[model samples]
Target: MEYTVVENSGYDREKDVFSHTSYWEAFSYRARHYTDSEIREMHVEIAIDLPDGTRTYEI
Candidate 1:
């Protein structure tokens, strides 16, 4: 599976930024920049690619 870390730090949906290729890498990036509370408030998520389809969940 592949993973992507999305930063939803703005109001413009089209301008959301994302990065990373693995869950651990993505989690590390988020951990460095945001506290657990901030992450929940910002709606940060990790998008995962599976054989079935892409899925997302709060980080």
Candidate 2:
């Protein structure tokens, strides 16, 4: 999975996340187990092709 990473400040100034549907859904579930600082410092973007179109998510 691949996505573009960007900083966002619209909603509480959180880092914006982008990825494929499958990766995003899985990441969402997995993120629940991580601490705030961990997620904040973690990098979750890559460059690759996916079946479905890319998506944007707010952390």
Candidate 3:
């Protein structure tokens, strides 16, 4: 399975960023950099590639 993660701050100070990987690296990256409150304020999406199709989730 492959995962693509996107983080959008919707602000000038932080630009939108994305990462594609076969593991949880993308999610982990966000955990390392942003605090819980900061993450809640941002728009975050996680897309997973499965055998049937792609499924996306937003937070």
Q: Whose TM-score is greatest here?
A: 1
Tens-place lDDT digits, model 3, residues 1-59: 55655566343554435556544687887777778887777755555656587554532
Root-mean-square deviation (CA) per prediction: 3.9, 7.7, 4.9
Which residue segments of model 3 deviate by more than 4 Å? 9-16, 49-55
Best by lDDT: 1
Minimal lDDT window, size 10, model 3:
9-18
Q: In terms of lDDT, which candidate is stronger, 1 or 3?
A: 1
Models 1 onward score TM values of 0.58, 0.28, 0.52
Candidate 1 yields a Cα-based lDDT of: 0.63
Superior by TM-score: candidate 1 or candidate 3 = 1
What's the lDDT for candidate 2? 0.45
Better of 2 and 3 by TM-score: 3
How do the residues 1-59 of candidate 1 rate in per-residue lDDT, one tens digit apiece?
Answer: 66666656333562234555678887787788778997778766666656587554533
- Superposed model 2: Cα runs more than 4 Å off: 1-27, 45-49, 52-59
